[model samples]
Target: MRFLPFTLFLFSSYSLVKAGTLNKGDSCNIGDNRLQAGTYQFWSECNSQTYCGSSGKCETRGCRKDDFPFGYAPDDKLPEKCPKGQFCPDEEDQCQQIQPVGSDCQLNRDDQCEGPPNFKELADTSGRGLNVNGSVCLNSKCMWANATLGVACIVENTPYTAYGVDGEFIDIVSRGNCQLGLYCDAAQKVCMAEKLFGEACTADKECSSWNCLGSGVCGVSESIPHHFAIWVYIVVGLGIFGGMFGTLFGLYWTHRKQRDEEREKRMQYWREQNAFHQNLLAMRETARASILSLPGNGNSSARSTLYSRDGAFSDDVSAPILPNAAPKVSGLRHYLADDGSSEFDDGLMMQSGKKVDGRF
Candidate 1:
């Protein structure tokens, strides 16, 4: 049972170490492989009040504000303000007496110079912990911020480093030694106002518009408008609607015209057919009347007997004669005596004789 407690303690310690909550002098792995310039390389991370040193061990941190601000440090290790008459150095891990104006200092390392006494108080009250006091390290020397428009200034072309709470560098950037809203001119070597539109510019910072066109001129922002004018929308809508309507109407008109033409052709054809039928009926009637008006035979009774009640020839009648009929003389009859017989009667007798011969 006593060994059980010891085992539990060892397990707990092992779990704590595995959790990565390291302490001073504990071995750790560095965060990344690429080490930045002008910054310290630390192993993993250490607990509050300590930082990983070059020897790969945790060492006590010197100044809090210079290395780790309130939010940059661990939650429980919020940094405090630097002591009076002392300032933090960028390269060292200790606080030193503040440097007076005109003293030798490193560029972009403003922490080494003296600033407004109330800067800390203002930062705490304003909720923005920025070192924006008049003092700044410019051109490798401590100086008060005085780079106004038309004033001589130095343009630092080299990049400067910024450190994280663990004294590890995080960012590197180049900002010329000029006051706010001013930029150092590379050619004139003086601070100048930001350029207006259409002015020649080489960089975005040189223009108040923050836009440097490819033609090397300060120009308007290049943002494309996503919304069109109401009139444009209306015009486009009308155009589409008109196009559809015109297409439909054109098709309808064409179809209607075709149908009308077809109907007209059909009607005209029907009229022609009707007229032809009517003319044919009239011709038939005239033909019937002409046939009825012809001279009748002298033997009316005989002619009447040849036709039936329906005005057609009777089946019993073999031959019928007209009223204007004349006897035809045969040439052979000149050689013989005149028979005194009508041609019609002779033709009937001959036909009757032929019938009798056929039967025999």
Candidate 2:
């Protein structure tokens, strides 16, 4: 499946030129079977030209600089060394065709093929090697992005580095302005981080890998997982908050209602109390007039009669006491109207606090 894409790329390059167009026996000077026209088709994709003659075959691509051998552009030429052990540096000192950009690519620490490339892949891939915090704090686990040394990412480790600090692991490959809480983009050849911890970036100060998009966030594409659980958390938090508010509101309402009821009860009691005092005072006035008119006796004929009112002068002990005490009058005397033309005799007995007529 991977070969299919390569084949397509080659086929497109060779467009007008067919695969294996040259025959083996046709080239007596160079063994033709060793190099077929199909190979010529593969070299043409970058719009590079194929010139084959004797042992010399030059494949040219577009816009290459005067120094390079081959590339996406011409002028960046690369020698047509048909096979392995070929040095093809098309402008990019680290770039080569042996392991094309996408193919079994490898970036070493040194400049040469075996000497220790300046940069290396993240893993010990291509059977090359893994730099475990080499030239840095090796207590923690870490890897290099590429031999270019333009980017690096610090992988946090539980166990402290040999240095004994709780800090981050030192990157094996460090080139860009990376500090704490930052990552480097070896592919794009740029320094990056999620909201840069230390380094400065023109685009995204917080970008971890690529550009810090217009949203202004750095590193991860999403702050929250954008999952059902995220929404659930938000909803649950809101519900809890709302419940608290409602509880407080309900309590306040209940408290207010209770207070209002209590106040009303107090007011009602006061009104009744005030009425009681007023009634007593009026009764005292009436008693005073009655005493003044009395004939020295604490009795009157009308006072003996039973009134229709519910508490009409009853002698019940629980009944309210009169506001004023009646004056005592003697039964040993007769009484006459104001003119002294008539005389009368009568008596009264204080029974159960009410005057009883006496005819003895």
Candidate 3:
């Protein structure tokens, strides 16, 4: 980010239009009267300058051509340029040029970090900047380490601890359900210690040894505490579904609907479709009979039937079709057609072993 000086930087300049001698011959445009030019102050406030700037100031692009005896800006240095954004401090002077600086840094989303130079170790004697180690110093200053980003540094202290502690990194304390001396997810900040209501326990699994008391250090799950939301979610879900099933049939009946009519209509449509299917099956069976030999009455031959299905027909519909090999009466037979007719030996028909001829 662009750093402002926090204050204005002022400077003095020697350039201002003085009422010195206008030192040349002057004349009146009308009539032949010649006027001698000695020194002239601004004849009026309207007598602005020897130059007319682009902004019409008394500088830069000088006077009009009509004002000059010969032409405008006769001298090569008749004008002075200003900084792009700024104008002159006064009409007689040149403008100062200044470079632009942005107000903020470009965002760097590397999940990495950035910063100004830091002080690694402050001097005890002299109150100056820093004394860094080999791993420090970028442009003569230290850099702070980001533990989260795994940024390393040749520091004099352990990470994640108060600067100058014991030889150990950090003293152990269970943040949640993790042990201090054991492994814990540092990101989660939880430890595997027994967070008991009364006293600190040796371990989480020692609840039974502590007599499973309400006040002693014990495992969270001798009867573990649940997240408030887990119980809320379960209860809310149960209530919603239970209320759906256990309706008094009042609000549910008045506002909610049975959908039984739609159900029945779908079922009737299915039945009509099934009947149409059965007719198709009978036709298929008749076609099969034309090409294939028929099973005899006494000399029975076991046969299998393939059931009819509407959609992707993946049903393993193979089943024995016959009444007697001792009349095993294998099952309701299927003819390869989209009908509800069960294929049987006599023809495709059966209702609890009673014959009723209809299209499937």
Candidate 4:
């Protein structure tokens, strides 16, 4: 249980780190150089000063710039904040106050005042009213639109704010409100058919859900939910533990089987030893009986007399005979021939019961 918390913590940290990294299909900001998916890490080919964005697209714009005046490194300093009450506009990079709706304005230069195409005087009814194409300058507000999809429009009853041409809401909170199979067209300011991720785009508004990266291709964000990461960690841990347990169990079974075989072998050896001992005892008893049946008492001479002079058991032959009438030869052979036998024969008889003399 103590190890459980540690294990969970380790896996949880891994999951959080993994979730923070981008997957192959996940979206990314323009400045990020590293994208991670599963166990793989992908490095963006973006230039040194540029980075991938949250829109999953690379961007040269909005890149951090060196604040040499503040003695900061290149691309390290943050953007300056605007003064209170005045909002900073992205196009001008400056702070300004809101202007009256239907006011005359230059595109991108006076975003704080909000106006479209600098065509405030060009209207359908009165110059103060809506434009000929249903565009309005109610509050001098204008918005970016994807040219491929929807055009910019204003709500009839509300203040003049940016909306899709199809009448769906389009704002920071209600982004693109496009219908099924449609995408918000920032260029055309309308909802249009969706494009694939890698399609060429002039701006982030053209991609289906991904942003047009600095490399000119659509990309996704890298962030993921914590629950998903936790689940992945649990699964991986379980798999590893299961594998280890299975290996241990397999080894135990193999050892047990070997022990059983060795036990059986030992039992068989003991059985063989008992049988040999029994046979040896029976042989010993038979020899004792045979000795008891002998004619003389249990003496060494009686045992020796059981065999004749030639080592054959014969009770009829008493002793060897010597013939004195035989001629003796000279030397050692002379003495040996007097015994009625040659030296090679000694005094033994063949199995056919014939006397043998030394001859060719």
List, residue by residue over 1-360, the lDDT tens digit for candidate 2: 000111123332334443333332232222332212222222211123332334433222222222433222564335433233333332222224332221222222211132124333232222212231222221221233343233544322111111116743321222322333344443464544445423344343234433344444334433335457688999999999999999999999999999999999999999999999889767755754564466534333333333223324435344333556343332322222222432233233232445423321
Task: List model 3 lDDT by residue over 8-56, tens digit each.
Answer: 1111001112322222222212122121122111121112233333432
- Per-residue lDDT of 29-103 in model 1, one digit per residue for the tens? 544222233332212355545555667666655666534332243555544556877765432346678787788
Better of 3 and 4 by lDDT: 4
Model 3 misplaced regions, further than 4 Å: 1-59, 63-283, 290-293, 297-328, 335-338, 341-348, 353-360
TM-score-based ranking: 1, 4, 2, 3
Candidate 2 displacement at residue 60 in angstroms: 63
The C-alpha lDDT values of all candidates are 0.53, 0.36, 0.31, 0.41
CA error at residue 117 for candidate 2, angstroms: 7.1
Candidate 1 wrongly placed segments (more than 4 Å) = 1-35, 38-58, 66-76, 83-88, 91-97, 104-107, 115-131, 148-151, 159-174, 179-181, 219-360
Query: What is the alpha-carbon lDDT of model 2 when measured against the actual structure?
Result: 0.36
Judge candidate 1 at residue 80 and give its lDDT. 50
Q: Which structure among the candidates has the greatest lDDT?
A: 1
Error of 2 at 241 (Å): 5.7
In model 4, which runs have C-alpha deviations exceeding 4 angstroms? 1-232, 299-360
- The TM-score of predicted model 1 comes to 0.37
lDDT of 4 at 290: 64
Candidate 2: worst 10 consecutive residues by lDDT? 1-10
Q: Candidates ranked by lDDT, best first?
A: 1, 4, 2, 3
